[model samples]
Target: MKVKDKVVIVTGAGSGIGNAIAKHFAYHGAKVIVSDINLEKAKKVSEEIVTNFGESLPIKADVANYEEVKNLIQHAVTAYGQLDVLVNNAGVGPKQMAKTAEYTLEDWDDVIAVNQTGVFYGMQLALQQMTQQGFGNIVNIASLAGLKASLNNISYTASKFAVVGMTKSAALEYAKTGIRINAVCPGYTESALLDQLLATRPDMDARLKRIIPMQRYGEASEIAEAVVWLASDSTKFITGQTITLDGGTSL
Candidate 1:
């Protein structure tokens, strides 16, 4: 599909994988909505987009909150007059990873609240708008944990699995409406900012590296390229599918 002029909204666009996806979409000529709880970071991302000659809207939004998601959609529509793609990528991992027997309710609550419910709200709102417009693409970013059983982090795994399931269900429901839905599952992405947190727990981080067949972690940009294709018309025939970008680890 041609990339120019499409209006795309990317949640959690301020940093990490989300930031890469937003910038990639913008660089490819999509008018992007760079939404996040961090308005300052969003503005910086938007300005970077502008400096690179792409149209962007930097909006403050909390994907975990339903009202904020609704407002975000409103903001995007107000700025662009229409929306073509919605990338529901906002999510938070479990606060503390522990054996299920030792996991706290607070950790479970936080994971389900932000990762699972946030995607639902964004999907609901985006689908409503897309139905009215009669043409759109929705891409949710899931994790390899969605497919593989995760230990010591039950909540995050459960939420991601739900996202994958929801993506398929939504795609089926809207297949006849000219709306396409899909999910992308990425594995072992190396985030310097996030890895700083891993430094606090060396053992867990080491374990993560060992499971992947690719000893090295994947780059954020590699995942970004996959996301953009799913958002584009080139994958027009594909729907309700989960594309895994796991560096052959799943094999």
Candidate 2:
């Protein structure tokens, strides 16, 4: 999975899984564009990559916004001359976990805006650029909730399921167009998001681990490695598939 010299754009790269993916790509010699709604965080990651002798640029963008997403794609193309890969990794979980009947419309809207609509914006904009260049790859960061019900988190599950469906639909449409689209579904990974969930319910950590056949949570780096491979030429024959990295949680 050689990504050397490839221009890759990873959204929501300020922290967590997005951060891991950005650094992983940089370490593999790809020119990574680290983007997030938080400019400072994005800059910090970009600087760290540069300090490590990797090429990167920090761009502040709210993926949920169409104009910002458009500008982000333009900036990357302007800097690298061509867009090679776009990791639609920007996502958000629900602020409060609730069952379907108890879920508020406000929470549902908020989660869908960032997790689902944001991904659509990135894929749509990236496809435009990739079509012109005749080749590109998109690796969307989904969740195991996308594959199965997450019990209390209705919005998060719905949004991720949308991502999975979107990935397959787009992949088929662009299959012969030289642009590949796929998704990685991680389960209970160690991330700031997971920390927040654990903080709310201190006992959830163990309960979550017990469900996984491997009896452990996944690591962000492990998810990142899979993402880089999917985005690389090594997965040329792979498209429209959602590779689950959830420690057999789905099993």
Candidate 3:
């Protein structure tokens, strides 16, 4: 019940890590906003939460759009009467354009639009509300790639690094306020995105085991758990840091 009755908005909550975080928040008694670009998927997640007797609302939003991100916060505030937490979890990756020189400008732009600009939009909008209320928490979903680097996946790595940087800067900016901002850098986790990446490399699983030290992929729920802790009042003193949940990959 760490987040009990807290109003939380999790972007890209339709599936994968985002979906798990949304459900986790609901299970902990938080009012969850299940948002995604796909209305159907968002609705499905929200319905499941409601069926489980949790408070939830489904909304379609393309975080890449600043206006839509603004509206997302507005809608959440309208429904819940206050904003408490925000998880900027929506992101996109290039299919086969991981190579820097060979990648098209469109591919780079698409990835940056969602992974980087989207986080900015969410933070700007959420900060507006939180600053006014004088209390808030934001968890930006970064990747271990941000701390290290993934060959050929330059766009994603760079974007996540930006998110980590923003998290630290914003945390410092609002340290005196009752707001906390942080980033979670998860390693190769079990998700559709991992499946897609694995499809490209036949030896990925074995390679991951050899390198990760833990010899296993991180679960979405594991990442979600860390996010919930960061959002909770129990960890109010923790801010301006990047929590790496990478199964010792960084080590």
Candidate 4:
């Protein structure tokens, strides 16, 4: 019951990991704010939550945009009266383009804007409100790429590394003031992007599975479980750190 009746904002909730986390939290009695860049998808997720007897606030926002993020937080506050948890989960990858040596500034900017800077803005605003309330939890969804040497997409790894650094530094500064920040570094999960990758490279699937100690790809729910644990009071003393759910791929 650590997160019972709490208010949480989960960005990118339209699909993939964000969607799973939003649903899981709602199932656990949290009033979840399902947010995403897709307005129609966000609305649908919100409706689904309600259908399952959970409270939800659907918000259309691009975390890459600062003004939109600001308004999103405002909407949560205006709706829920108090903010208890913030999951900075909105992100993108270079799966859109695989050419690193031939990568464009436009390509690098697009990924960094959403994956890195977007997390920064969300954390800043979430921290601002949590400080005033004197209690809150912040979970930034980072990636194992931050810990490894990513070859195809350098910008993605760089941004995720920045996210991990920001998580630790902010956790240190805010832990005393009642805000706890942490990150979950997920390896290859069964997300939309993964499906897309598998669709395009139907042959590389086996090689990819062999890289991880676990023979199977991680699920979005597995990552959601980690976020939920970190969001709850069970992890009260576990700030300024990262939990890698990568099936020992880092080992």
Candidate 5:
């Protein structure tokens, strides 16, 4: 897969999967915009990219805020001349696990704000720029919960499912205009998020591994590779598709 010279923006790139995607894209010669709510973390990732791979710019933007998202896109275009790809990867899980009926309104709203509405904001703004350019790509970071029910995680499941739906709808609407949209659904990936989860529920580690066919968590780099391929020219014919990287866990 080749992404040389492409200008790409990745949200939530301060850590975890988003961080890996930013570095991987830069490694492949893409000029990357590492956007995160935390300015310092984003700067650290951008500096590391510049040191080890290629060009990168760090920007602070909370994906949940429409205005911030708009500015993020504008800044990327101003710096790079054009936008080639946008990865809506910023997301948050419930702070406390609860069933649908027991789920708090606050948790639900918080998760939806950053996970669902945030994705829409990024997609909408990126679409405007890509429409003008007449060619672009988008890779949304969805989750296994999007494809199937995740016990005690209604908010996260709902948000990710929306991401999958939005990716498909937007891909179809823009397919004729040279913009391709797609999503990657990962299951139990090893990241800060998972670490937090495991910190509270130490027993979950064995339970989760027992259920997954591979008996191990997916790596952030593996998910990044899939996103890169989707954004690359090799998948020109593919659009509105959700590629699952769950080690057969869905099966």
Candidate 6:
């Protein structure tokens, strides 16, 4: 019940880590706003939350677009009296693997639009509400790739690095305002994105296990747990930090 009665907005809550985080917050007694580009998927997650006797609202939003991002925050406020937590978890990867010099401009733009710019929109809009209320927490879902560069993942790495940097800068800016901003950098996790990445590098799964001390991929729920803790009052003094949940892969 760490987040009891709080109002939370989770972008990209249709599936994967986003979906798990949305449900986790609801189970902890928060009124969750489940947002995704796909309305159907958003509805399904929200319905499941309600079935568990948790409060939830489903909304369709593409975080890459500033207008849609604005509407998302507005809708959440309309549904709940105030906003307490925001998890910017929506992201995209480049279509193909390529060295930095050979990466396509189109892929770079697409990835940056969703992964970097989308996060910017969410943070700015959420800050407006939280600053007025004088309390809030934000958890941006970065990747271990943000901390350490990966082979042939130029776009994703760059965008996640931006997220990490932004988290620290923003956190410092609001440290005395009763607002905290932090990031979670997960390693290889079981998700549709991982599946897609594995498809490109057929031997990646085994390679990853050998490198990671845990010898296994992380679960979406595990990452969700860390997110909830950061969002809770338990970490009131913690800000401008990136929690790496990569099973020692980054080590």
**Model 2 misses residue 145 by how many Å?**
0.3
* Candidate 1 Cα outliers beyond 4 Å, as residue runs: 192-197, 203-206
- Candidate 2 segments whose C-alpha is farther than 4 A from its true place: none
Please give each candidate's TM-score. 0.95, 0.98, 0.98, 0.96, 0.98, 0.98
Residues 53-148 of candidate 4 have per-residue lDDT tens digits of 589989999999999999999999999888999999998876554657787787699889999999999999988888889999999999998888
What TM-score would candidate 4 get against the native? 0.96
Local accuracy by lDDT, each model: 0.89, 0.94, 0.93, 0.90, 0.95, 0.94
Q: How many backbone clashes does candidate 5 have?
A: 0
lDDT of 3 at 185: 97
Candidate 6's TM-score reads 0.98
Residue 85 of model 6 has an lDDT of: 98
Q: Could you tell me the lDDT of residue 136 within candidate 5?
A: 96
Q: Residue 90 of model 1: what lDDT? A: 83
| Number of backbone-clashing residue pairs for each candidate, in the order shown | 1, 0, 0, 0, 0, 0
Residue pairs with backbone overlap in model 1: 1-234
For 1-251, candidate 2 gives per-residue lDDT tens digits of 69999999999999999999999999999999999999999999999999995899999999989999999999999999999999999988777887899998988999899999999999999999999999999999999999998878998998999999999999999999999999999999999889878987869888888898999889999999999999998989999999999998888
- 229 Cα displacement, candidate 3 (Å): 0.5
Instruction: Give candidate 4's error at residue 14 in angstroms.
Output: 0.4
Q: For model 6, what is the C-alpha lDDT against the true structure? A: 0.94
Clashes of 3: 0
